[model samples]
Target: MEMALCNIKNPNELWSLESCDELEQYGITISVCTDIFSTTILWMEADNNDGDPSVFLNHFLDTVTRIGGCPQRLMVTPSRENEHIATTQTFLRRNHTDCYAGEDSVMGGVSLRSHMWIHTCTPWKICFADLRELGHFTGKDLDKNLIQFCFLHIIQDHLEEFVGRFNKNISDHNILRSQDDGPAEDKLQAVLPEDIEVCRRRCTPRGRYPCDETLFEYWELIRTENGWEVPVDRFTALKLYLHLRNVMETCIDEEEQVTCIDEEEQETCIDEEEQETCIDEEEQETCIDEEEQETCIDEEEQETCIDEEEQETCIDEEEQETCIDEEEQETCIDEEEQETCIDEEEQETCIDEEEQETCIDEEEQETCIDEEEQETCSDEEEQVTGLLQ
Candidate 1:
């Protein structure tokens, strides 16, 4: 029923551990174990206080025990935290678990796994921040327990929602896609030519580092040899997770549905997909492509589209959508109000279509009528005569 991937009996199953800081405002941290092959977060918790290494170790031990102890192999990361990393590695080793730690085998450790955590923490932190702000968990003398009481279950719901969305979301093949002949590294080098040498040296198999070919083949062999039923695709994983959740009676509480915004007026809610991909921080924006502009037009929502190259704003007024084209100095409205226009070409003023009788055009373009049925005149040089009728 647990979100686990490693089979202790199977001698080839492996998983990796990574801890990242979360909710600094509330003194919380998160540690997660992920399936190396599937890249799914198997276990996670956010109760660690003060970034203490022992707290992570305790969680690791609890997770290991729950999963029946001692998988075929375990990889721990953020090697800078030498205390807990060393302790966890030693414990795994003592239990006959192939411990991959520090700057050892590239397959089971660090470099590749670190990328997953890069954008992962931001979304969770943002969610926590929103909850704190909305719930008014401010003030210096506020009780810590009260804050946790209000936010913990809600945050857990968000986490579970995120996990469901993340694991089930189909991955598109990008520059980071794994390949046998170093396609990922090649693509990376092509994009980041400055790090070409670093990519070559690190990506290439040498010493304790095993090639991608070896790792893939080993996993395939182990699965085939043991006849282990592993979820082959994300669809299968999603189905399995749903079934397990049902069987285990795990669900988000009804009270956790705390409204963050007014229901009637909220234009859009931050969905799980958006949270996972949202990059609002300047530091995080570096990962986004500099060449690609993020101004993607949502035609479904706006009823208008911008042709940036031609410097044109195309408005479809059938839906009564109004748009102003700044480039052409034009105003467009629905058919009902098409008469209301300001034409810069002839220095002319237009009146509302609803009251066309009120607008009188002069032969010399000297006079105009306002929407209020007042008569006004314009000089040849486009000066308002202020003639009252």
Candidate 2:
């Protein structure tokens, strides 16, 4: 961007001043003031065009005086006495008697500002479009103050950029008029702001007049109230942007918390299902072991019952054989008793027969004793021997 200088060599010299035609587009009105001597853009303003005209004119004069001494004369477009610009001119003439102000056509029926507009208006249309695209300002009912608040710095930057480009190149009108003056490049003149002498050096007024207060204070005031209204200035618009940013951050935090809760619940359900599966498997194994034990006990009981039945049968057969042998021994003792009784009866009968014969022989021997005593003694001896034999 070109460095700005108030190129006033003589503070008392008469200077001519004029402005380009007002360009209004996209709910903004722009006006530019050019110094006739150096063809420099001394002041430019972008606004809603509804402000008090007196306020605007005062700021313009103050800005001019700050950069250099106020111009000696000022020329404006033709207007009726009742219109805004004409009223402002009347007001200036009434209050400030030092400046000689009149219409541009006053100089020999030729407008001084008509030729300057041809060069100035071309770049302005392009700048306005660029501003719209960059700011995203669409539709007819646009929020003019919000756009200004957001993009005011960008507007100033673009103005500086245009100043740099415009100062380096020669205008087409000047090129045509200087055709006889050799090459067009040689005719180009660089008007640097540093080279110009002025009464003082101050900040540029192109984008500085809109807002002057600190924006942080404005935002704090609105946040403390926790409420909003349609913004009437740049300060209020900035506060609205900050409030909306806080709300968006809170919503994002809540969404993350809800997602975490859902993940935890899903994991809990999976754990419960696995525990139930483990229990079922243990019960099934217990049932199988019980069945195997019952089958073994049944086999042992059957073997014990078969051994008891065989033992009882063997004891009954041995008892029957012992009773038969006892009965046969009693019958043999009875037969020996019967044979001894028959032998005792036969001995008693033989002894009784011998006793009867001895009695008869004693009676006969007494009768015969008188006759033959001697022969009887000898015969008795022989008979006794024969009888004994």
Candidate 3:
């Protein structure tokens, strides 16, 4: 006969004696392990098939309960087994207890599971069970989610207080408060005396209580010394810090925008001034050019006048020369006339002398005649005498 081995795959699947009998007839043996929390199954060969399976299952349940069914303890190796088992035992003890007796009993104290159960049972109980175990939590322990939750709670309870402390009137007209509101107050009001008395009567002073006074006083004390505390006063201080930070950031952005606008305006003004200066320079150049042209025209006119004066002087000199030549010709004509007159006078004088000579000749001839007559008489007388002789 060939021996066969088969394993059941799923614990959730139906198991029956009839199926086991059928597997046995085929010479097969099966074993199963089930995890209660996950509803999973593990299958393996039935090495010891002689024992009853019911007895084994019952023993496993009992053992799992005793160990609190902590998966970490079951999975750890021999080196870390002691630590894992200790942690699981502490959780089991805390789960069973309702509250711790004192600080000495805080080690292996009440777990968060018990506190959650209590919270579910009494929804109004705001117990800080974990704080009792850990003494205090701060900084990294206080994340944004917790801070926001605390902040909302503060706003719900003390909104009026916050507004009044800052001297802000949140009227219908004021939608969002302006930045002009003064600084926020550093401290917040403690819980009322009647509320504290009620809390005191309801629970022990050192024990966990649900009222606002206990939490507020506790946080204030912690903050006074450490400067870091949990959101006990509804996170009033944290809200103020956040508000101031936002205001400072807004102011900085506005200043930067104004500076940029001023710079652009200055640049535009400078450009306009430069354009005006260039236009003025062009106008000056045009005026200088016009003046130079007018000077050239004046010089040209003066030159033309001088040329005309010189031409007139040349004409006057020519006229004067013509007059002098005419005067010399007139003088030469006068001298010729004088010389002809002198010649005529000399001719007339010569004629008179010739006439005088002719008259004298006539007179002398007459005298000679007379003298001849006398001589003839005398000669006749002499002739007569000579004739007498």
* Number of the top-ranking candidate, with lDDT as the measure: 2
Residue 24 CA displacement from its true place in model 1, Å: 2.4
Shift of residue 293 alpha carbon in model 3, Å = 4.4
Q: Which tens-of-lDDT digit does each residue in 236-315 have in candidate 1?
A: 43333233323222222332333333442243444543555564544377545442333323442244423442234222
What's the true lDDT of residue 49 in model 2? 40
For model 1, state the Cα shift of residue 2 in Å: 30
Q: Ten-residue segment with the worst summed lDDT in candidate 2?
A: 184-193
The most accurate candidate by TM-score is 1
Candidate 2 lDDT over residue span 1-389, tens digit each: 01112433222222233333333444444445554434555555555444434434544555444664344434344432113333333333333433343332122112455555446545544644654675534434333443444434444445556666664453544455456544422211122233222211221323443433344345336556775654443344445544544543465478777777877777777777777777877787777778777876776677667667666666665666556555555555555555555555555555554554555455455545544686788899999999999
Model 1 alpha-carbon drift over 4 Å, by segment: 1-14, 71-73, 79-82, 95-124, 127-145, 164-389
Root-mean-square deviation of every model: 44.5, 31.7, 35.1
Better of 1 and 3 by TM-score: 1
Candidate 3: list runs displaced more than 4 Å.
1-296, 354-389
In candidate 2, position 103 carries an lDDT of 39
- Greater lDDT among 1 and 2 belongs to 2
lDDT for position 230 in model 2: 45
lDDT of each: 0.43, 0.46, 0.39
Q: Model 3, range 47-84, lDDT digits (tens) per residue?
A: 11223333233333333344333221121112211232
Model 3: which residue pairs collide?
A: none
